[model samples]
Target: MSNSARILIVDVEPHIRRLLHGTLTRADYRVTEAGSARQAMAEIEANAPDVVLLDLGLPDRDGLELLPLIQQKSKAAVLIVSARDATDEKVAALDLGAIDYVTKPFDTEELLARVRVALRSRLVADGGRASIEAGDVSIDLVQRRIHKKGEEVHLTPKEFAVVAELARFPGRVITHDKLLAAVWPRDYERHIEYLRVIVRNIRQKLEDDATVPAIIVNELGVGYRLMGVAG
Candidate 1:
C-alpha cells in the first residue's frame, strides 16, 4: 500500500498519532509521527513530506508560533488538526499558510477528506497537476484555455494569465502586487486597472453569485485566493 504521498502527523497524544498513522498507512501513504514541536521540526528537516497534519497545542510551543518555521523547512502543505476551532484561530492559521483547519473530536471521514483536498491543492501549486475541471468550468494550462459547459470561454491574455497564476496557489492568497507582476510583466509597476478588470471578468464567468463568490474570493485590500471547487 505504497502511495507516492508522504504525510507527517504531529500530536502529543500517542493514541491519536497511532490512529492517524494506521489510517494513512492503510490508505497507501507513507506516515511519520512526532510527539513534540522539536521532534516535528527534526522530522521536517530529515525528510520533507507532502503534507503535514499539525496540532496547535504542542508541548514545547504553540503550533501557530512554529508555523513559519515549519513552512520554511519544507514545501509540504500544512493542515491544522488542532483542538482550537475559534474563529480567530481559524483566521490566523489560514493567514499563516495553513490550507485547512480541523478541530479535535473530528470525524475521520472529514479529516481524510480535508487531507485529500490539501494534497490535491498542493499538487496544483507544485505544477504536478496542470489543469482543473469543476462542474462546467475547466482551466487548461498547456493550451492556456478555459471552457464553460463545453464551450470555449474567451479571455484576454492578461485575464487568462492572471487566473492561471492565482490558480497555482490554491487556498493561498496571492497579493495584488504579486498578481500584477505575474500577469502584467513589465507593466505591473503602473497598471492596476488591468488586474481589477480581469478579476471582475473571471468572477462573472465562474461565479454563480459574483457579489458573494464561491470560487475566487477577494481578500479585501490584499489580493485573491482560489477556493476548492466541486469537481
Candidate 2:
C-alpha cells in the first residue's frame, strides 16, 4: 500500500460516489469511482488501487463474485461497503479476503479509520500470498515456493516454471503451446512431453493422491489448469 493509498469506490449511486470521492480526497487519499462491476474491474486493472470500497448492489455482477477476481489480479485490500448489512454477507465477504466490512450508513471517520488500518494491516503490508491456494496447498509466486499441508514441497526449476504458469491464471485452461513457450522457450511444441513430465512430478509432490489428482487438473488434449482459489 502506498502512503497516499489509492482507493477505488465501486457503487451505482452517483451521490454515494460523490460523497466518498469528496470525503476521501479531502483526507489526502487518491480516489477513483466505478458505477458497475465491469467498470470496477477496469479501474482496478488500470490503477491498481491499494484499497477497494466495494458495494454489493453492483449493476453488472454481485460484489461477492467479483471479490475473488480482484484477488486474482492484484494485492489490493478489499473493503465491503454495502447496504446489505446481513450477517451472512459480512461473513462471506471476510471469507473471500476482504479486510473490512463497513455498512452503507457508516460514519466517515470510522470508514477512514478502517482504510488506514487496512493499509497497515498484515493483509496488505505483508501481502498475504499474491498467488493461488488449492485445498491445503499454497503456491507463493513472489517466493517461488510451494507448500502442501504446511510443509515445504520442492520442485526443479522447470517443474516450478510449469506450476507457476498454471498459477498465473488459476481455473483457466493454459494451452500446451503456452506452457511450452513459458518453460521451453527455445524448444518447439515437441517439448510438450517435458511439460507433461514436470506436471506429473508436481502432482506427485503436491496432490493428496497423484493417481486421482485434484490440485492440478489435466485438460485432456488442451493443456492444464490449476484448480485453486486465487489469492
Candidate 3:
C-alpha cells in the first residue's frame, strides 16, 4: 500500500498506457511508462522498478524474449499484461519467471489484487529477515530451525534447505528445475525421488495431516508452493 512502490508499464498502445497510468496513480503507486521493449529495457537499466507490467506484443521484439533480460537486469517482478489468451503463452511466461499474467480488458480490481500479491512476494524475497511465518509454521532462517504450533519440528539439513527456499516465495510456485538447482547445486540431475522424500518429511513435520497437506502443495510435474499467510 506504500506510494513509494515503483511500477513500470510496458505497452505499445497510448490509450492503454494512459488508462493504466491513471488507475495506478490514483491507487498511490509511482508508475513509469514504456511504449516499446527497447524503451522498457532502457528504463530497467537506468533504474529498475519494483514491478513491471509487460505486454507480449512490442514494436521492437517479442516481450517473452525480453523476460530473461529484465530478470537479469533487476529483481523486479514481471506481470505479463498481454492481449494474447493462448494457454501456451501463459505457460511460457510463467515458466520464464513471470510472477503472474493478465489479459487485456482486465478488471481493474483484479489487476490491483494481482499487483498487491506480486508486491508482497517481492517484499518477502527482498527482506533481510532472520525468520518467516506462514499458517502455523515458523522458520528461523538464521538458525535453520522450524517450529509448528510453538513446538520444535526437526528437519534434516536438506529438508530445511528445500523448505527455506519455498518459504521465500510463499503462495508462488517455484519450478522443479529451480528448486533442484537450489538444493542440489552439484547434482542437478538427481532423481525427483529425493525431492519427494524431503517434501514428505516437511509435510509430516508441519502439516497436521501429510496425506492432506495444507502448508506445502505440489503442482503435478511442475514444482511446489508454500501456502500464503492467512488473511
Pick the TM-score winner: 1
Q: Superposing all C-alpha atoms, what RMSD in Å does each candidate have to the true structure?
A: 12.1, 11.9, 12.3
lDDT (tens digit, per residue) of candidate 2 on 98-165: 98899989899999888877665623354333457878988765445688888988788778878877
Q: What lDDT does each candidate get?
A: 0.80, 0.81, 0.82
lDDT of candidate model 1 versus the reference: 0.80
Model 3 misplaced regions, further than 4 Å? 1-3, 127-231
Candidate of highest lDDT? 3
What TM-score does prediction 3 earn? Answer: 0.55
lDDT (C-alpha) at residue 112 in model 3: 87
TM-score, candidate 1, is 0.56
Ranking by lDDT: 3, 2, 1
Q: Of the candidates numbered 1 and 2, which has the greater TM-score value?
A: 1
Better of 1 and 3 by lDDT: 3
- Model 2 steric clash pairs: none
